[model samples]
Target: MAQLERFAETRTPASRVDDVVARMRALGDDWPPRDGVAVFNRVYLSVTEEVARRIHLGAFPDAHAAITLDVRFAERYLRAVDAAADGHRPPACWRPLFQYRRHPGVRPLQFALAGINAHIGHDLALALVDSCRTLGCEPADLEDEFDRVGDVLVSLEERIREELMPGPDLLQIGDPLTHLAGAWSLERARDGAWASARTLWALRDLPGVAQEFGERLDGAVGLVGRILLTPLPD
Candidate 1:
């Protein structure tokens, strides 16, 4: 416990993200490559690495603020990883994906999409608030950086679909994956995250209101995650 806490304390945002990328890479190398979670981990690892490299090159106007936002964003996922490791419950939005992580019937695309749903749907809004608090600014101030990060995620979604999508022989016009993918939109999630972040910032002074809003968001996202993780017939 002491060691973990100490390790957490010592890591700056960049180092923490680097560690996450490394851990994800190791998971990809060590775990079954076709395992759904492993597949998403690999996809997410690519996004993280890209984000970290951009951060190094001063891609953003405000590096500190960007780092704060990125770190807070990454920390939510890391916390889920830690909680699951320790046998503790993670956020509801994340529970479905974790529960279905190794379900053989769940496709790799489902896993990737489910994880994205959990992270963007629940964590992104809260992370904006975290960055706001840490940087002592409003959510609006972080919009540019948020959009940049979101663009990276959006591209990852494309890569994931192209790479993990079932072959034409296995896919049909009415396939469950097709229907599911058609319904879930990263653009919508990104827009919603922005709205939620603004709302959270507005409710920041009222902890009770903020908590309620966040809980509702969590529950809604969890429902979506559940649907995304639905095991399809092989």
Candidate 2:
């Protein structure tokens, strides 16, 4: 409890990103090469570092809001990490990546996609609302920034699919990875997240119902992540 509070106290928005980056790098260095979470961490860390660079360059219209959204978003994942480290269970959205980290059948592409699916699908929407509360504004006010951060994810998603995709020479149409890659789309996830942020904001007064809805969303995204991370045969 004391440790968590101190971490909470000392962590600025910039430092939070740094902490996550450093932690992800450490995990990658220490964990096995094929560990699912580590694989996803490497991809996410790169994107994060890019965002931090953009933030430094004053790339966004409202830098403060952008940094807040980015940090709060990263903190959700970090808290999950801290919880898991403390022997408390992480949120359902994060369970698959952690549970399947060592599964040999899951490829790095699947790992990366599953992590994106979990983070953007579940965490992004909530992070938007969180930033709204902290910034004292409506969801609409952050639309541009949301789309901006999302643009990065969308671009990264395309490159990841292109780079990690099995070659046409080696890939059969029946390949599960081929099918899985086509099945999930980051655009759809972004659309869904926008809708969720709107709905969650509307229901903010009804905390109980909002909490239930968030939990259900987390579970549904987790199920999809688990499917994406399913081990396949060579």
Candidate 3:
């Protein structure tokens, strides 16, 4: 808990992408290797670093929009971590990872996937809305940035599986982990997030409906995240 407090302190204002990357790195350093949140943080940190590098190299078509969207997207995850550390309930989409962060039966792959599920399925859409509001633009204007970020995540998903998957000899076809992993697709989640963002943006004028819609998305994503974190034998 004390360690979490220290890590939470590392979160600076998310005005700069480097600050967000640095804070996530601090979290990766503070958390033990097996801790579920730590595992997710490691994966997220890598994505952030790559995104930042691309932004630096002018790889994104609109670097400003890309940087804004990336930072906003990351802030949502960091806020959830801070909320958990402070003993508060995070967004519904994040509850499962926080609840199962240290369960012995949960594999590193499960942790990584659960985190990705929460972030991509739930946070990404809202982050799009956030970026739009901040940049005084619409979701359509940010679609390119969104796609670029999604591409980075999709590419990373393969590597994450390769690195976190159990040895092939032990991971037989009958393994529950194999079945569980096959059940969720990052690409599908990314598409859903984009749709959700568009819907949410359209509902911006209808605060009541928008709030309800966001809540439903959060709960639905949380359900998927919980399923992804299902424990299996070592």
Candidate 4:
């Protein structure tokens, strides 16, 4: 947390996106490839890099909104990482991943998906509100940016499944892991995130209600993450 805070303190607003990429890259280098968090980090790092590329090419209708949303979105996940590292409990949505990070029976795909579930289901809505506050715009104003980022995540989820899915011989429909993976949908998660963002935005005037809603959102997302991470047989 201190390290990231210091880095943020020195960074200019224009460099914030780059700062996020650098932090994710550093985390990747530090954690073993098979570590559960590392698995998610690799997946997220790839998505972030792709989004950065698209932003550079003017792919978004509103690049500034996209960048603000992207950076704010990434910060939520990074803060969870920092919290766990500092011996503090991460958000409910993140607890499952951190708890099962090194479990031997959890496949890389499950680790990856669980992390994605947490990030998209819980972190994204809050991040949207954060971005809106920072940009002085409503969630509706950032809808295009939100959808663009969600598109990147949806595409990446497909790739992650392909890369981490077991071979066909072992991935029978009867397999528990197959069933588990089938139950969660990145596209659905993305849609839910947008809805959640709107809901949070509406509740913004009631800070206590918003906070409670956010907490419940975190717990519900965490429950799904825990299920996604259910251990499978070797």
Candidate 5:
């Protein structure tokens, strides 16, 4: 339960953004199977920034394509998980970090997972940009486009929050724990010791609106600290 440091005192938005982009690029070309969340978080932020910048510069086609690609990659993960639920094994194309074998109906879960992560990534990026705006940076050159993206994310967050596990009226809707119980049972039956060891790590830790954000915010912020804000070279 440690608090994240406030980003309030960061350097000007433009400088901080350059720093973020540089640090992300410096992460190099290797991708870890276990780093799906980490990698996507960085890529989404970079894409969002690019879209914002391009739209500002009046590069409409470029901005449109960038956003399209971001949604495509993220949504594809959802599709793969869906396919896996229909008796198909996960596709080899997806990173191992996302491949689920023991669980059924995991496709929707994948969507929930990726959607939440992307939401957090965008949230942090916007916070940085908003901070920049407060610092008197020129009118983002495309404030309307930026706001359009923000509005889509806001709608998506609400939709995902209501559909994914232990929804708002959990008391009436029943616990996701009960539904995913099959997943737990499968894991235990396959390997109880290992499953027992890892179950607690999967529990959701917050409630209501904050819970929705909390679902992926920690992982996103962790990346910002670990990869995006690492000390830059002189």
Candidate 6:
């Protein structure tokens, strides 16, 4: 049976999400160093962003795909989403495309979202590299992810340009105003998810999480935290 089918027999999306979060916390607790903690944190955030992006893009038939079938592929999608979400210069790309009618008010938010998206992608790329080193998975394939994200962003930007500047070459859509509105709708969702991921990560503590993952390690998370947690023995 497919992986989703096997998972469906035992648990729902809510349960699966909980399990994943718990696993993240445990993994964090097990690995204590700064690099290890960073890796664990990025993996969790990357998976979350990937799931959100897939859902937004209709890559799946429905919401269930977010929690079910796509669970295993989150890391791959994370890389894809991050790559496309970064390297966008709205003024250069969107301005010409929109005939220089750039809305200054929304530009800041757009840039902010782009920045957040890049950070997410960068973290995921780093984590993938670390995982390849430590876990012996197939090579991280960071280039592929970067290319995928760049392609999507460019495509979407072209689509937006066409919508805004409907010359003889650029055909009309449902309605120029409505189309821009709708395009921004997807942008908002993507931006919101990026923001949420940042907030969640700030609130979480990775060392505690690692301990949960590697419960067997003596003093596990504490061992790493001790030096930081206490002053040198005088």
Report the error of model 2 at residue 172, Å. 3.4
**lDDT tens string, model 3, 87-197?**
999999999999999999999999999999999999999999999998899999999999999999999998998899987875677889888888899999999999999
Q: On a 0 to 1 TM-score scale, where does candidate 1 land against the true structure? A: 0.91
Candidate 6 lDDT over residue span 75-176, tens digit each: 333333333336533211111212211223222222322222333322333333333333333332223333343334434544443433425532346533
What's the TM-score of every candidate structure? 0.91, 0.91, 0.93, 0.96, 0.30, 0.26
Error of 4 at 184 (Å): 0.2
Cα error, candidate 6, residue 52 (Å): 6.7
Instruction: Report the C-alpha displacement of residue 149, candidate 5, in angstroms.
Output: 3.5
Report clash pairs, candidate 3.
Answer: none
Those runs of model 3 whose alpha carbons end farther than 4 Å from true positions after fitting are 1-15
- Please state the error at residue 209 of candidate 4 in Å: 1.0
Model 4 Cα lDDT, one tens digit per residue, 33-82: 99999999999999999999999898997887898888889989999999
- Candidate 5 per-residue C-alpha lDDT over 80-143 given as tens digits, one digit per residue, 9 for 90 to 100: 4345446665333332324421224333333334423333333323332333334433224434
Error of 1 at 183 (Å): 1.2
- Displacement of residue 46 (Cα, Å) in model 4 is 0.1
Indicate whether candidate 1 or candidate 4 has the larger lDDT. Answer: 4
Stretches of candidate 5 off by over 4 Å are 1-12, 28-34, 55-146, 151-234
Give the winner by lDDT.
Answer: 4
lDDT for each residue of candidate 2 in 1-234, tens digit (9 for 90 to 100): 233335644677666566666766776697777777777777887778888888878888888888888877777777776777788889999999888888878888899999999899999999999999989999999998899898888878878877777577646678888888888999999999999999999999999999999999999999999999888887
Candidate 2: RMSD to truth: 2.2
CA displacement after TM-score superposition, residue 159 of candidate 5 (Å): 20
Most TM-score-accurate candidate: 4
